[model samples]
Target: MNRTLYSGLWWLALPAVLGRLWWRGRKEPGYREHWGERLALGGPAEGQATIVLHAVSVGETRAAEPVVDALLKAYPDCRILLTHMTPTGRATGRQLFAHHGERVVQAYLPYDTGSMTRRFLRRHRPRAVILMETEVWPNLLHACARMDVPVVLANARLSERSLRRGQKAGAVMQEAARAFTLVAAQTELDAARIRSLGASNVEVTGSVKFDVTPPASALEKGDWLRSHIRAGGPERPVFLCASTREGEEVLILDAWQRLADKPAGSLLLLVPRHPQRFDEVADLVTARGMRLARRSQLDLDHAIDGADVLLGDSMGEMFAYYAACDCAYIGGSLLPLGGQNLIEACALGKPVLVGEHTFNFLDATIEAVGDGAALRVKDADALANEAARLLRDHAARMEMGARALAFARRHRGATLRTVELLQRVIR
Candidate 1:
């Protein structure tokens, strides 16, 4: 369907959207509090030219960090209007940009109906609208075009799978693609895909996520966490499953269990992608007869006492987990959920392992494996074997970690390149 039909359907689906929000709000109360903002009914921040940047959820919000910083530095006189679809993303935006004071204004991006889109644009009067990867809304793009608002797709990527899905929509996606004033893609493959989808102005800008340097404080905290987890004295290998999805946790646990003769005090850090699933994952670990420690329970003495597993249940602490671990199994790939960012682990100089499905970060994963920075296993059992072997062989693990750091360092200019593109948009 085209933009007209899509907009009509979106309008008709508002009630369903609200119902879904109500359902999600039962587990996460923050969703219940932001109804007005989702409808463009919130109060606006007066003064300063606004540039609206949309990051859909937690991952996108995190990836936007460097871009946000660059934007803040480049346009000190302007206010950054950050918009998000999920409560987690909103919370992250606030946490990340709180230091900037009123310079950063955050709210929900209205649903892609003409009325809501028009109302939001009218309210913000933004100089330009920048959308994080893969957030192509036909009505929103159409509305931006009509209002003469320049729209940019930053750190954009379109996998073969996503391209095929877009092909199903045909003209709707093509029209939406045309609305991008600039498409700063993560790779040349992404640039080609976006061009195939009818994006005219596209550039290969790598991934802005690569530009995010883990602060010294986070690294120090990670060192402390490592010591805290191994408080009983024997230094054990720490394995991290970062940003895991639903089915992957069970597979990960099974893999961890299958490892023969794991070192005494070997610790597995399991981090779920969603906050609501923290308790669920912790219970899963307990059900498997493993002692679980939650990161949220600040009492490290009590939390880690005789624990085999540490549940990374806190928000915005992914870097600490990456830093603390000796080797990491980047999650979401095992079950075809299109993988989380493996770059964070690599940046911290950790040996990385991933499952077969990493199409979400296909280029990065392929490059990492090719560079000997990571190992990709076929299934859960292979993952267990690889992790076990790497843990046992310190020299091999350190070699891989060195490669991982080199791989990360080589791809570090995307944020600056994207900011250059944004400068042209504002100009």
Candidate 2:
């Protein structure tokens, strides 16, 4: 199908889309709060000079940080009209850019109906549109093109599976692909895949995630968390399982129980990717007879020395979690979900473990594994074994952590390169 049919379909699905949003809001109230913005009905008054940056959800929003900083610095006079699809992404944007004040305005990107997108464009009057990662909407791109707004895809990546899906989407996807003024991809493979979909101005610009520096506040919080975890006891090795998806938690929890030689007083820091699943994961820990303490409930006065697991139920503390852990297992990999980012763990000089499936970050994973910065386990069982081995052996853990930090340092210029590319389009 072409752009017209795609827009028509989006329009037809409006009711069901609203229904789904309402259903999702039962768990995450942020989804329920932005109904007008979703339809391009209400937002800031039009004609503000702004740069539109679309980051779909949490990961994209986080990945967009370095670029956002660069953009703000490069264009001090212009305001950033940040747009997101999810409430978490919106919240994240708010937290990350709150200090910027009126310079960074945010709103929910409307559904990809031509009329709605057109309205959104008119309301924002963005000088250019920069879509983070792989958000290629036909109606939105078409609207941008008609309105003469240059669009760039920054920190772009397209896995083979995603490429196959795009190819299957036929002309509509190709049309959207061709609409991009530029694509700054994470790797050469990503550039090639994006090119195959008709994006002509593709460039290999590495991942912006590598350029993200751990905030000092986050690191300090991590030290405080680590101190609390070891309060009145010997130092405990903290193993962080971060950004875990739904089905993978059961496998991980089961694997945790099966570890033959888990270090004494070892702490498992379990952080689920979605906030709605925090209570569900907490229940999983309690049902399994593990002593649990939530991050939300912990304080300087509260001691969690006896707890087997620390549930990271709070948002925007991932950097602190990375800094607090001795070793980190990047989640979403254990069950064939394209694995979560291991870059943050590596940046923190923590030994990293990932399950076999990391196709989402394939090139970086391969390079990190080859450099001795990261290790890939075949399944949940192997993940537990390797993590146990690392925690038990201090020398091996330190060596791997050193390698991880070195690898992270070697990839620190993506944000600069990405900004240079964006300068060509962002008027």
Candidate 3:
């Protein structure tokens, strides 16, 4: 498909897209709150936007933190215009950049129609557009090209599956790929795959996630939370299963229940990836006859007693969860969904466990496992067994945790390289 056809299709699907947003809003009200911004109808008043960065969802929003901080520091006079596709991404951006005040403005990225994108670009009048990760919209790229606005794909990655899908998209995806002024890829493999789709000026700048430092406030919160988890009883090992997707929770819960050799009095911390599913996950835990306590309802000062499972129902506290746990199992990899980021857990010096289907983070997972920072299990049963073994062997856990921290520290400096690449296009 060509650009005109792409734009026409988007216009035709506009109503359905809006309807889907409304449907999703029944569970997550944030979707209903930002209706106008998605259409380029209303948002922050016109200002000199130095850069417009699009981070699609929570993971991308969090990954963009280091790069955002670097950009702000490198260009003191610059004001950033952050954009997102999901309400959670918008909320995460708001929480992460609340300290910047007016320096960082945010909005929902307008629909990828030629007119809407053009309106968005004209309204912001940013020096350049920087799309985080794998966001390459055909109409958006065409609009940027027509307007002579340079676009950069920062901290980019493309897995083999995604590359195959993009190739199937054919002309539209190729044209979009070619329109990028530069691409700061997370790995050489990513750079090569992006180049295969016709992107030029691709540079391997690594992942900006390595540059993100856990906030002191979050660490302190973790310590306090750990204390509470251990309060009123003997010290218990906490196993965190974070960023779990739809089907993974059931498997993880079943595996936990079937574990015959698990350490005594160990607590399971289950955090679903989507907020709308928190209650659903809680129900899953209760259905299994396990006691569940929600993080939202718990008092910070009180001890969490007799709860076999703690449901992490809060948002923007992933780092705190990482810091509080003895071992972490990064979710979304058990059945075929591309895995979630395990780097946060590693950066906190926690031993990590991941499933075999981590194609999305294949490079990072392989390197972490090779460096002894992470262990990859083939199935949920193995994940449970290995986590149990780690909990029982304190020395093995400590040794692995040390390697995890070292692996994290060795992979820094992506933010600086990405900022330097942005500098080239901003001028």
Cα deviation at 62, candidate 2, in Å, is 1.0
Residue 342 shift from truth in candidate 1, angstroms: 0.7
Per-residue lDDT for 1-427 in model 3, tens only? Answer: 7777878889899999999999999999998987888999988888664788999999999999988888888888788889999999999999999999988998999999888888988888878899999999888888888889999999999999999999998899999999999999999999999999999889999999898899999999899788888889888899999999999999999999999988999999999999999999999999999988889977743647688899999999999999899999999889899898888998999999999889989999999999999999999999999999999999999999999999999999999989988888886
Instruction: Give the Cα lDDT of each candidate.
Output: 0.89, 0.92, 0.92
Model 1 is weakest, by summed lDDT over 10 consecutive residues, at 296-305
TM-score of each: 0.97, 0.98, 0.98
Give the Å error, residue 251, model 3.
0.8
In model 1, the runs with Cα more than 4 Å from the true position are 300-305
Name the runs in model 3 displaced over 4 angstroms: 300-303
Per-residue lDDT over 1-427 for candidate 1, one digit per residue giving the tens place of the 0 to 100 score: 7777877788889899899999999999988986888887885664579999999998899899999889989998788899999989989888888988888888888888878888888877789999999999887888889989999999998899999999998788999999889999999999999999999999999999888888787888898888787676777689888999999999989888978877667889999989999989999999999988888874535548488899999888889899888899999999878887899889989999999899999999999999999999999889878888888889999999999999999999999999998899884
> Looking at candidate 2, what is the lDDT of residue 314?
91
**Residue 293 displacement in candidate 3 (angstroms):** 1.2
lDDT of 1: 0.89
